[model samples]
Target: MHTRFTRALVAVICCIVLVASCARLEVFATSTSNTKYSNLDSSKWNLVWSDEFSEDSVDTNKWSFTIGGGGFGNNEQQYYTDSTENAYIENGCLVLNAIQESNGEENYTSAKLSSTSSWTYGRYEFRAKLPGGTGLWPAIWMLPKDINVYGGEWPICGEIDIMEYMGSDRDTVLGTLHYGNPWVYNTGYYDINGSFEDDFHDFVLEWLPGEFRWYVDGNLYQIQQDWYSADSSGTYSYPAPFDQEFYLMLNLAVGGFFPGDPNPADWTSTKFYIDYVRVYEYGGDLTPDSGSSSTQTPNVNLLQNSDFTTDYAGWTTWSENGAVFSVADSTLKADIYTTLPNTWSTQFYQNVDVYSSTTYRVSFRAKSSVSRPITIGVEGVNNAALFNSTFTATPEWQMYTYDFSPSVSCSGAKLLFFLGNVDGSQNVEHTVYFDAYKLVYLDRKREYIFR
Candidate 1:
């Protein structure tokens, strides 16, 4: 009886070990198999715009600064100014300072910045680092420029609040859209929150066909659509007035609606810093494949495309100035002989599943023409997160691979190719050949375990 029991125990332990090993292997396979993608061409959009704060100072051509004391529609108690002392760029960021003192009519002086250019339907994002202190109100918002001329009202023109931080609550940021409505003070407010004053965060607004979505660091926080009703005579009208484009505004208002006036006894300077702002639009011609209904799975094959071969089967060639794309001995080459300082090297275009971030592998074939060092990198549309490599290409064609695993920390990432001075420096110029470019699936389990 004892011998039989021992044999049974041994069998059970062996089965458990086998199951654990299989589970680990499956995770590795999943991690390895997933592929991520993004569109390489940005020209399809009517406008791909951003405010990177690259200017030595704020550009008055693009943004206007509001001045003086007015009702400001919120009973706030700060004087806005366009003066260089109140607002400027330092250390690669826009600074909107709130300083307490007798300046003009108010006890505090700050900056109220706005964009004269407006858009109707698009995606908007701002990368910002905020300030925290008592009696400070910083906001990135939009309002219809011709509201009084066309609709004769505030909410009628529509308002989109991308991000706001009130003095009382430094940790929270809010996003709400105000439209022509009756139940809630001519507008309704929806908000999402994040810990401001700590690190940089991305505030996003996606305005699609009939609905709008708001996100803080790619997390959906609010949605507004034409589902509610409001009447014409300042009453309830279902499906409100959101069909128009709105102008963009940024300001640091002191006190009033939420953050209410600075305390004179414990006064210090507060700063609102913005890193970058970007906007993207739908071309309407490119239709995304939403996946198979029967299979209930995304088509992974659609996410993979590369143009490193001589034939250029999967890519559209983009050559400007002296840039050239041709093949030499089974290697795809981009030749550049530009005397023009502003000329861009050859770029390739591909459509990708940009909305999701799964594991991915992007590899390319390369060989050097000269003995100098070169750089290869990837950049997204209206983005600054660049993944780069500094390698001395050999005479023989060799493969180089890069894997992308996005954690929750990254804002947005995409695939791009470059072969020259990526930082826009005047010195870097090179000729190189590429071939056998491949984007493959990742085995996630093994990926994570190895990591």
Candidate 2:
């Protein structure tokens, strides 16, 4: 997944507040454990596949080489080849080496390998040590097995980036999901306290129906559930692109759009080491305790004056490009007089308390004088995004609903709606209206099922 770095949507300002209290349901798994894996519990997961890289050479039955020098759509400087000089198994690890030797028109040569097998939903993990040098880009990613299934290629078929590391920035790693016809993507990053080149670390992606979670060294960092894919006919149903089988890819690219051109003075060569690759599937059932059955409580709206009966009591509106917000006719109104640079330039939001692992629903009725798109999501006080989705607002009023669960508890969270021009493309003035905004807590019940 290659994309240009763009401006962030949220600007976090730290604030101290009282943490909200929440009650959690206790559930237990009764299955017996058999596996000896350290990070995974045998009662919940079953190892389905793995590659330890102990063989004397690259396993041709499991991996195939992708050889080229056309930059691979990223204007990269490296020419990928299957030569052992670029890729080979050494000391029980799969080594991918990037050398400065010229191969035809390209000034550098590297290697890329794709798994022969594909999978739909599972836990994918990679343990590896990253290479560091100016202009080096190492990645462990996935692409759909059938690219033409969802209309066209590339973004339409979807891409899951399990891990991507820049040689220059050795402390940060990115996990991203690429989808949508016009090419929309969501990315999450983890900042390692130390350089990734110092040692091998575990990068994992737990992908299930409609949900994707990313972790580094067993620490959960990012989660995303809102995405879409479309073609000539129309938008496919929820989770269409991700529902298909996808194969794994490992590559070390030199220079190009992501990390820029590598500086030859920084290093003559670098090596990426992979200790293993493993996959797992859910095996056993987890249910609630027999004495305490799952039950739902009455929904309680957490927002104040949601209907704008008197004024914007608990809501706040802000803009950088002179957009004005007011309460009119029992609806929250925004009048945009000028175009903005970013989608979040003109914003409307409210602070709310959020509980970890608890589900919350946001419902609202909205419309715009001119048809356009707006983004809505929940963000932490420190600017970490919990969930977000883009929606088109037509002249006719329509109801919108979103449900999400925060992975971590936050005393201060913002539920925001962004009405500025999306992608800096639309530069016209328009008015938008929001009414009947409601944020409610949805209590989840635990139900136990015997195996």
Candidate 3:
């Protein structure tokens, strides 16, 4: 009987030791194995792109500003600008502000930004809080990377609206796709517990070859697979637009063809905050891990302070021979008070991100006191010149455009605006003004201009 009692005692001690070892082993666990795949299926998914909006200002490298209030073919009333007052980064989120103000042509001003990157099939996710007010419409959507990726015009190419919220119906969030030969639209919406302005929520799109699923938080809200495109020639089969690559877009529109005007009392200033945008591709290291439930994302812009609205924030200046650089009236101005012609002594420059073997388009507005010439180009910050051109700036403000494609890839490329002509020897004193400098990655094939 004593021997039996001793055996039982020994077993108890063994079990205690085993429990202690397991507690210690937990310290060695890998973070990768513990990643949460949200509540949805993330099998074989790999994270491809993300923008956390951690910077105090928006990064211009991965995004391009889409400026204009041209109704966006929808009769939207808001005039979109690159101004930070209309769009900015605040408290770790992108704030797209829509306010009532007439720039003469439009009664409202808002901001729209588009991603420079495009993808085919992936899981696109975002965390956001909407701006609420009657007649306001905010959208997170995509258009075909190639305006004519399929044969024919838009809708044929396709459109994917991941999420859209209308101020008229502050509690509903919508998902939709526009396709077909004659341009038929399919859409669905889910009601939220409360106004999106009251809290942040997850908006996601799981896009596959033929099937597209829309979800709010973790609940599936919509699914669309059957779509068609009718063209002058013929109607394509299902998935014509769904099959091609598409680039993402974010905009807060006011008074469009869909939503009507707002009551002045209800049309106060409000902001749509986007916390992050994440893109995950299938067949990555992550498998449908049933353990995690969080998501974050990123998108970038190559140039900082391209608008010169932040007091020369993203620019480096240099001058000599009485040349001076300053910001006035929200424009970059260089006054070469003393005569020193053909010298690059006075310059304003910024280094931007670019990829090799890729083409980019640069456009800006500049003017001079006289018909003076200026040199603008893109080169490796400390390396070879990829693009350079000399143009004569007229007295009136004019838009100048040039296309650049680097043979070699680079991340920190220099965008130089030589205030004084580089090759001229005339010592004529003059002033030059610049504003609205925009650089964007171009898909040459789809440079068909627009969808």
Best by lDDT: 2
The order by descending lDDT is 2, 3, 1
Compute each candidate's TM-score over C-alphas.
0.50, 0.64, 0.54
For candidate 3, write residues 1-451 as lDDT tens digits: 0001113343343233222221110011111212223334466668899899998887888789977755555556789888999889999999999888997589999888889999998999999999888878888999877776576455466778888877877888877776664444545667867788888999988887556777888877544444556577765554566767888888888875455676557754378999999998887433333211111011123466778775875565655445777788889888776445434556666655566666677788999886777889777522357889998788899999887777665443568887754665245677889997777766665553411
lDDT of 2 by residue, 1-451 (tens): 4632121210010000001111111111111111112134446767888899999999999999998886666667899999999999999999999999989899999999999999998899899999988899999999888888786566777889999988988898888787876665556667878889889999988887656778889877655555778888987876678989999999999986567679878753399999999988876433211211122232666676789986775565666677877788899888887556667767777656676777878889999888888899898633568889899888999999888888765543678888776753367888889998878777555332211
Q: After superposition, how far is residue 73 of candidate 3 from its true place, in Å?
A: 1.4
Q: What is the C-alpha RMSD of each candidate to the true structure, in Å?
A: 23.5, 13.3, 26.6
Candidates in descending TM-score order: 2, 3, 1
Candidate 1 residue 219 C-alpha distance from true site, Å: 1.5
Q: Give the Cα-based TM-score of candidate 2 against the true structure.
A: 0.64
TM-score comparison, 1 vs 3, better candidate? 3
Q: Alpha-carbon error at 22 in model 2, in Å?
A: 38
Question: Which of candidates 2 and 3 is the stronger one according to lDDT?
Answer: 2
Residue 203 of model 3 has an lDDT of 92
- Model 1 TM-score is 0.50
